[model samples]
Target: MNYIALSYWHLAIASILILANGMISLWFRLGLEKTLAINVVRMLVQLSLIGFVLKFIFVQTSPLWTIALAVIMVLVAGREVAARLTTRLAGWWSYGIGTTTMFFISISTTLLAVAFVISPEPWFAPRYVLPLLGMVLGNTLSGISLGLETLITTLKRERTAIEARIALGHRRFEAIEQPVRQSLKTGMMPIINAMAASGIVSLPGMMTGQIMAGADPVEATKYQILIMFLIGGATATGTLLAVIASAFRLTDERARLRLDRLENAGSKNV
Candidate 1:
């Protein structure tokens, strides 16, 4: 395949948003002055490296490498979930919840589709499996993050009310019902809406990529619809479970509030 180098104008046009985001972060007092710079640098470096790594992986065409890359993404995503929600929770439990839920959802969806629907050659093909898993995990990661944030903030803000509810004869789940459900719903709404408005409001990335690669639009849309439905299922499951898990971090063995726990749980393990 012939490659075309981007001209200076093209490069500037591409980077406009990066420059704008950094400027806005500074101007609006986002308190991410350093973070903005770091993120920009990380994005540039990581994407550049990922481009080469992906090329190598595709050429190597080893199932091991493909699976390893998928595992790495899951681990990284797991770390983010743990760091964002409850840092002191210890090893592999976060990995358990994050990666397990992700794999469960992705595999289940893919198998159901492959068995009953599109039976592609080598159903576990790296190209198909990796991207499908990425889509599920990517959305689920955001959902998990939102769920954790909601749970933490809710517990913090309603500490007194939650304590009172506990005293008034309510189980932990019953007491935290409203907040937990709200968080789950809030976390999953974006994915739900994306599904609802997919064809009308936007050309989804997967479909667009497939069409750009010269696949039939009809075939591309079929894959896009399948992935979205599967992702929705994954998001709902992951978000609900993550919120429930986060709630445990805020309560103790006696099922009582542990407000002080939040302080130690905010550290990023990275």
Candidate 2:
């Protein structure tokens, strides 16, 4: 079966939903109408641009282009992770941690999947690699952001308690262990919930798209399951690395808590 093409008229008609949402926000004086409108516009523009770029990359099917695009995705995701943090490590530490963790986990997982699970002809096929990497990088980005933000916020709020533990002869790692664990848990919660609720509660986006594009339901289900597993693994690995790295950056060699390293130490403005 051929995929149904959506024309400009169809897109315009579909955009009514967003307009209605913005109108509702405006009527309620929620102050979100502008944000909603802007986000809608941004989403359209960004997705359209990416769609074109991806089309080109798919046509070219060059390994260099694929690798460059993957690197760009990781860099952007890392910046997003850094931006989401309420309190960030000084200088490039936050970006470095996020980028390094995301790069390692996303690349490793993507390679494993492509090489063993879903080996295409060229092995570096843009179609498979790009989409898979995008999913992994996107999930890992969110997980790392959530974990890092939680760790920073918790450390700021629980400084007294952490210091008390430290004064009681506990190591820095010991003092911050609870917060680190909590942060990791918080980061993983979204993926866990999605995994638990998949299929029964809702059809995931990928599966829905695949089914719409005329893929077999059983095949789509299998692909969705693989993607979910990859996402989960990437999220956990990235979150753990990011949270632990940030935790270490929060302290000194003397096991002293250094909240000073954070730019906005006790603020939840993020």
Candidate 3:
């Protein structure tokens, strides 16, 4: 079987769904019509650009270009993680932590997958490396962002409770243990739920794409399972790192809560 090509008319016709969604939002006074429209446009433009760029990079097949693109993806994901936080640590700490955690876990997982699991030719093949890195980084980005935000918000909301624990001789880590655990759990929930519902509720993107491209169903499913496991591990590692780092940032060496380190959520500037 051959993959069917979608033409301009096909895309234009498909876009009607988005327009209908926007219209529905407007009709209900949901205030999301503008956002929906803008997001649709952005998604179209970004995906188109990336499609062309990936084609070019795949043809070139240079590790340097592949690594550079991977770095760019991680950096952008890191920035997104930091931006999503309602309250953030002073200076570049928040952004740095996010970037570091994402880079470490995503890259490590990608390398392991490429080197040991998939083992594509050249090991750093643009086609395999880029997509795998993107998938891992994308999932990690969401997990880390959620974990960081949860930790920051919980620390601020429960500052008094945490301080009381500290005053009662509980270590800083002990005081914030529950919040940290909760944050990690919250961060991992999306991936976990997706895993649980994957085959039963809906098909995953990778498997769907592969099947559409005429791959064997069993082969596609095997690949999807591997990818899911990789994503889960990456998300868990990244979320743990982000939550723990944020927790430490929220306290001092003296085991006192350092809510001062956090900027107000609605503050104009950091």
Candidate 4:
């Protein structure tokens, strides 16, 4: 079967499902109408804009365009990860930690996949690199955000215990070791669960899309499996790096807990 193209009318018909959601919010007096409406508009606009932007880039052969988009994606992901944190390292450190780790992990993994695994003619081909980069970056951003949040929140809640450990001659790493481990685990759990449930309980988006596009099921599964493994490795490495970097920022040379270094971030009245 050939791939089917969706039109505006088709999109409108599909949106009826969201009305059901809006109805539930009304039934429960949940007052989610405004939020849902705003979010729907945001999603539509963002997705539409990207669709056009991608269409334009698809015809271009320049590696520069692909690289430029990759950089923008990283910066945006970095800001988003920082913004999602209830508490984060103050100033640029909040953005720096997540963005830096994600940039290295996601880009390197995508490059490796495109150059070695996929091996398309022009290695920097947008068709291959951008999707791989986007997937890896999105997953890595989640991992880094969760890991950073876990580290900062744990430090605040365990200030007394961490300090006591410090007084007992434990280094900063020793004092916060448990939180670090738990943070890495928390950061990695979503991907772990998804991988576990992938073939059994659900089909991943990439696999589904490929099959819909007429690729053989076996080939599609292979691609999805490759992407999943790359995402898993990137997520793990990015989470570890971001968590460790943020932990260092929240401690000092004297092995003291430095909760003062963190500040609540996100949209709020200053």
Candidate 5:
């Protein structure tokens, strides 16, 4: 394979764009200027390190290295989910919610995709495994984060109504079903909207990158459709798992709401 070298001019242009991202972030008052810079820098460093590591691993074709990378990816994803739900859930509850959501959706889709779709030589090829896991994990992370926020907000807002329903002999889950459904729908709107407007409004990152990498446009489109469908499945599954797992955490014996229990939910415990 031929190697491509980055010229000084291209490096300079890329640096300029990176700087522009920071400047424009502050200019727009995104309210996350510091966060924006921190995340961008982190992404740059992490991705740069991963690039080299992947190159080595792929060349060596080490199954051990591939397994290690997959474990790291899962750990990273689980941590992200735990961090996202920390504010609204307690110790084991937070871990349970995050882990269940990620494991169920990611493992299920990945197994099916790899077994039947990609069909790698060993069904555990690092190139295919890592990329697919990253895609599913990244999107599921976002979905879980949004779903947690929506569910928590709704629960807080409807605490009185929910308590009344529970007091009226309704089960904890039954009392919260409407809000749960509504919150899930709201949380899922972005993915739904993206799917609705995919081709007309946006090319999506994966498909665009594939096309730019010289893949046929039609092939790219097919890949994009498959990915989007898979993302939708993962998101729905993750959201449902997170929400349902969290629901149990917010209820006590006799199926009553337990708002007081969540008073201690925060990063310290997570």
Candidate 6:
């Protein structure tokens, strides 16, 4: 398969669409032009930097570098998960739960895939591990953010009913059981819908990228299938961990509701 080369000039041309969107934003008084511009720049800088970093890592093929980068990515992603919460837990708990979940789920799942499934020359191959880890973490992060947000927001809204349940002899987990279930459902819905729509409604990003880069369609599909399953599994597990941990944090050994653990929902610290 032949690969077509793209230069920086091509990217400049492609960026015209973003410029047009910014223009439209300004014209419509959408107040999104500045945001659009800033985000475009951020995307360029971040992607460019990562490209260089990945190049260096791939050349070195060092487990140490790969593991270090993975840790950094997990920490950054964890902080981002916390930032997405409208009502976050006070202090480090806001980010700690999600971060820990992402690290365990993403790293473990990626390693299992690389070791048993793909089994690249080196199990810790940066090229395979980093991208797979990124995808797993990204999906897991989404599910967790949604689950935690829904759980927290719902707890605040349904505080009275939950407390009533508690007063009526229900345990902490029992009182908030409905909201927890709802949160889990909300968190898993995206991957569920995605799985449903993957072949017919859309081609997944990884599959599409593989095809574009001249991989055999069926081969790309097999990889995509593996990825989807991994993502679904990771997302569900991570979301469950985050929601359950949060629930525990929201209650004490005495089984009392502890809303004090949460920061204000409206005043986003980010």
lDDT of each structure? 0.74, 0.90, 0.89, 0.88, 0.78, 0.91
Whole-model lDDT, candidate 2? Answer: 0.90
- Please give the range of 10 consecutive residues that has the lowest summed lDDT in model 6: 261-270
lDDT tens digits by residue: candidate 4, 1-270 = 699988899999999999998999999999999989998998899889988877788799688888898899999899889888988787889888878888899889998898789998788888888888989998998888888888887888888888889999998799999888989999999999999899889999989999999999999999999999999999999999998888888888888888988777754322
Clashes of 5: 0
Best by lDDT: 6
Candidate 6 regions with alpha-carbon error over 4 angstroms: 19-34, 265-270
lDDT tens per residue, model 6, 68-187: 999999998898899888789987897889889988999889988998899998878999999999999899999999999999999999999999999999987899999999999999
From the highest lDDT down, the ranking of the candidates is 6, 2, 3, 4, 5, 1
Using all chains and alpha carbons, the TM-scores for the candidates as numbered come to 0.85, 0.93, 0.93, 0.93, 0.88, 0.93
Q: How far is candidate 5 from the true structure (C-alpha RMSD, Å)?
A: 2.7
Candidate 5: residue 203 Cα off by (Å): 1.2
Q: What's the lDDT for residue 119 in model 4? A: 98
- Please give the distance, in angstroms, between residue 162's alpha carbon in candidate 1 and its true position after superposition: 1.0
Over 4 Å off in model 5, which ranges? 1-12, 15-31, 263-269
Q: Candidate 3, which ten residues in sequence have the lowest lDDT sum?
A: 261-270
Error (Å) of candidate 4 at residue 261 is: 1.0
RMSD of 6: 1.9
Clashing pairs in 4: none
Give residue 88's lDDT in candidate 2 (0 to 100). 87
Write the number of the candidate with greater TM-score, choosing between 1 and 2.
2
Q: Report clashes for each candidate as comma-separated counts.
A: 0, 0, 0, 0, 0, 0
The residue pairs in collision within model 6 are none
